[model samples]
Target: MTYKANLTQYLSNEFKRLYEEPFNTDVTVQVGEEGHSKIFQAH
Candidate 1:
């Protein structure tokens, strides 16, 4: 499977594991260049 597809599956499984239910909410992942972690905002 593709990276995004795998990520989506992982997110769903994780959400379910935590909440004991399926993940129905939308997800958005923003990637950046190396050393750009500082630019991303914390959720």
Candidate 2:
């Protein structure tokens, strides 16, 4: 209902999707072009 609540929901859903990937597979975190890609961890 509130701005914070909406953002929280979106982040939670994203976390679930990323977590559901194969346990051993690295979750790629792309931000820009292929030369400027970035990988990050949830924690």
Candidate 3:
């Protein structure tokens, strides 16, 4: 598996854990080089 694949799986699991459903919504995210930073904005 590549880095992208692992990240995708992790994000999917997290979405399900937090929302109790699959991550099926359209979304965008900004990640910093530190790898632990996430920024979300509503437009």
Q: Return the top candidate by lDDT.
A: 2
What are the lDDT scores of the predictions, listed in order? 0.51, 0.56, 0.51
- The parts of candidate 3 lying over 4 Å away from their true place are 21-43
Per-candidate TM equals: 0.46, 0.46, 0.47
Evaluate candidate 2 by giving its C-alpha RMSD to the native, one decimal. Answer: 6.5
TM-score of 2: 0.46
Compose the digit string of candidate 3's lDDT tens values, residues 1-43. 9999999999999876765422223433333334322222222
Point out the higher-scoring one by lDDT: 2 or 3.
Answer: 2
For model 2, what is the error of residue 2's alpha carbon versus the real structure, in angstroms, after optimal superposition? 0.3
Model 2 lowest lDDT segment of ten: 34-43
Model 2, residue 8: C-alpha shift (Å): 0.4
For every model shown, the clashing-pair count is 0, 0, 0
- Candidate 2: which stretches are off by over 4 Å? 23-43
**Residues 1-37, model 2: lDDT tens digits:** 9999999999999987765453325434433445323
